[model samples]
Target: MDLLKTPAFAAHVESLLKEHHTPGVSIAIVHDDTFSSAAFGKSVISSDAGSEERDCTPDTLFDIASCSKSLTAAAVALLVEDDVNFPNVKWDSKMSDLLPEDFVLEKDEYTRDVTIEDILSHRSGLPSHDSVYMGTKAKRPDTAKSITRKLRHLPLAKPIRSSHMYCNLMFTVATHLIETLTDKTFSEFLQERIFAPLNLTSTFLQPSSVPPADRDSRLACGYSYRESTSTYHAIPVFDTPEDQGAGSIITSVNDYIVYVHALMTHAPPFTQAIQKALVTPRFALPEYNDDRERLQSSTLIGLGWEIFYYRGHRVVQHDGSISGLTSTHFFLPARNFAAVILCNGDAGYPAVAALVRELIDQTLGVEPSQRLDWPEIFTRGRGVRGEAESEDADGEQKNEEEKAPSSIDTAGAKDMAELTLADQPEKERGSEEKYIPPPFPTSDLPLDRFTGEYHHAGYDSFVVGVRASPEGGEALFIDAADRCMGFGIALEFVCRAEAGGDASSPSPSEVKFLAYLTDVDECETEILEAVFVVDGDDRTDAGGKIGKARRLGINLDEDIEGLIWFERV
Candidate 1:
């Protein structure tokens, strides 16, 4: 019996989707060059009960997210071998030389020493400064070149080549490099050298660019599940010009299966050199001993693909997540097997990944007794390691008992905080105990003193201004709509710092304000402290009139302790 066509397999796939609350899924499996495809559930759920739901099909287009990296890596490989156009360029070509004006990192040494392979393999020592770009879609769009230029300001989290840090910004840099080298847009290059040649009709760089005739009808609507209501909410598609090389590919499993098969068989554009470059392990990923170990033995990263050992077979894969979709692509070259799962739900990676793992095991003819029930494990509350880390990131949110000046990552800290804490009561989003100002004496300084534009080169600027508070009073607020976190927040006066309770207690020199960040769904809330340092003193107000603040400190990223001070501009 065909594994993918079996009734038991179909039932398991549907059960996994229901367990994870994913609305729709499309999958394509390739075994020994034979293709099998399946799609289940509605791609677009109609808000009106009378309207017909758009059923997901093999042709339904989805944003493949980071899986696009494989295509970008392939494009670069083609350019490397194009001796007529790029005679001197090689895999180790220095980025500083390729895109000299735009490829500056924090340290001058890194900027000069970094190479094409370094960025492609994610060993450039840069962390995912994703906050710098995540929510900037509503604002003036940033180009790949502009994003690459912004790297000069974001500090590297570790020394170059010390470890593998998955940084999307590096891929964006690759996009810029491709554009600079070929004198064409990244999309143009891919279309000419890869997509068109392969006859991938459903693949496109963006939704708007998808063929107009089929655009609205064939594109899938993305969604995120709201556990509170047990309902799915539509999420806006994440399409940004700045994310081209990093995660901007919109493709269908039908089209992606062709590409993945090409990868497995060393098809045309995917020549021996390209296949070797794409599969050669460049760095060892951090060891994880999670439920995934039941299926795969180990994992490493090559140019844009993650190489893992599933039993004894080598599988190269990548997973991508954006606002409302998650995708996974897997291919085992030795067995001529490949598969892709595309789910149009924000939290669907777990189920989709389990399906892929199961499909791979079946294709390899692994003994049924030895096969792990991945979907069942996920239903039993255990999740894939990568998705668990992504979903639990907000576990680092500051506790209510913590002191003022506590901070969180502005990008996903708020959203992930909500997901991790959703099991908690909703009204407790900002309970009285949680919002209470610290015990320190209130400063007599006027609130106006803290109002100004606080600037961080990496995250741009945060404008602290006066706004109406929830309690019917004027208060200081940070207009963060244009920032990466994508929401504005109100700042409440917390307290003024004091040295000690003894007679030696010195006058306060810093004032704190509590900022409440609510998730987009308003299901939960997280708080951050913003403290401004008083530069000079005026005696009449409180101990003295507070001078203008020149620096504001907020602790960002709980894993990395310390305050991130934004200069008052």
Candidate 2:
């Protein structure tokens, strides 16, 4: 009887947290074995307006990002059920024989054929370069075996096991193969194997290992939504000690409903041959990454759960997003049922995926016009979710040229450099007179000989200087230190060598520039481009001039290919 203590399921989760400006959410369910929990608003919102808000309960805490890849695939299925300290570790072992110089990749036949079941079912052709671990701790820190040895300088976009790409660097190479076969520390082997054998006391692995008195009253505070001051700020608490096994854990929908009721009651270390080797079904998710009005379908991907199917039950889910939270986690196992919502702004994942599809259509009864309103299709247009449109049933508000073109809403952003330059307003960001300039009035060379430090072995270096231009001259910037999240990128120049060729050929010592990329408080940008090059007979010196800029190229993961060069430190 706990359909969220009804009142129409708590007014349809408070009208989807007032149609997604989302102050807070918490839900938990369980169904047949009966459990049911709920929470509603404010786990600290404060963009000033007299601060102090706090609420959101059922033991708050959060982060569950990338749903900590199903507890790092049940801690690598408890080291494949501990055959004496991973005796030849199984899930198809071979990560070049477990960690040969940290799982080398970019082909030695995909570093001798990838495994741990091809990085827990992501099929290992690795393409989530996720901007190479975003601002990599500003200068350089990374360890999950140095991000699995920067996957031997990245670049694979498909072919070793062929598909399902989703990589958070192969779960930080399964947190460096569970700290090289359990010598420990993937946060002390997930707090002594799965949060102390499932007691899950508010779970941890991050928020700086949460203790200082339940780290400020049972954790939770994460948010973001500025939309030119319609407020809701808050966002801090980002302590991903190097994404331990991809997306650091955190927890609390009363400790992830006892780790989703210990995988819907199989309990004790979820054993049935580690729950059929973590739900079997390996690849298949790409029919435009399936949703089909959410009945989901065969969808697949097992080890770190996804599974799919919905109306015909079978389910098993996972959803997570880091900075400024958003989680989901569901289960079904043919209806033993399980839920777990958790949301803290960044437009709270379309109200935590419409309260995990309205508590799986109220624990499978289904009807109400066959469910799926999902807050009226994610609040029908303000370009699909920054919201403003949805009104008419005679109440008006729709036509701003029939809306839908806005886009760029990187929900809760921040993979570094503070929640995209903290709560906005220094006269609307991007300063140094917003650099810009050089939209090709045609000038070659001399931009301080294309400045210094470039490198890129998996996105690591970035300097290139010269700034001041709001037309006072001298542009080309990019301090991408914390990568785009720290957004200083402005460059400009735009072409000298190959882009629609021969307008009188001869400008060849190579130049090209372009930049934009934007996240300086949004409005989508992404142009990028870069180039520079010289590399032969070192292009001039012995005093002939045009020197210093050796090699640079760019394409920061536009599904990688033909760029990324860097070198010239």
All candidates' lDDT scores?
0.70, 0.67
lDDT of 1 by residue, 2-89 (tens): 6666788778778877878888899888887788888888788875333347998888899888888888888888988888989877
Model 2 Cα displacement at 327 (Å)?
Answer: 1.2
Which pairs of residues clash in candidate 2, taking residues 3 or more apart in a chain or in different chains? 115-118
Per-residue lDDT for 287-398 in model 2, tens only? Answer: 3231323576746778888776767778777787654667878788777888888888766676676667777887788889878677666455223312101222111234
Q: For candidate 1, what is the lDDT?
A: 0.70
Lowest lDDT 10-residue stretch of candidate 2: 386-395
Worst 10 residues of 1 by lDDT: 433-442
Best by TM-score: 1
- Evaluated at residue 365, the lDDT of candidate 2 is 85
How close to the true structure is residue 266 of candidate 1, measured as C-alpha lDDT?
80
TM-score of each: 0.84, 0.36
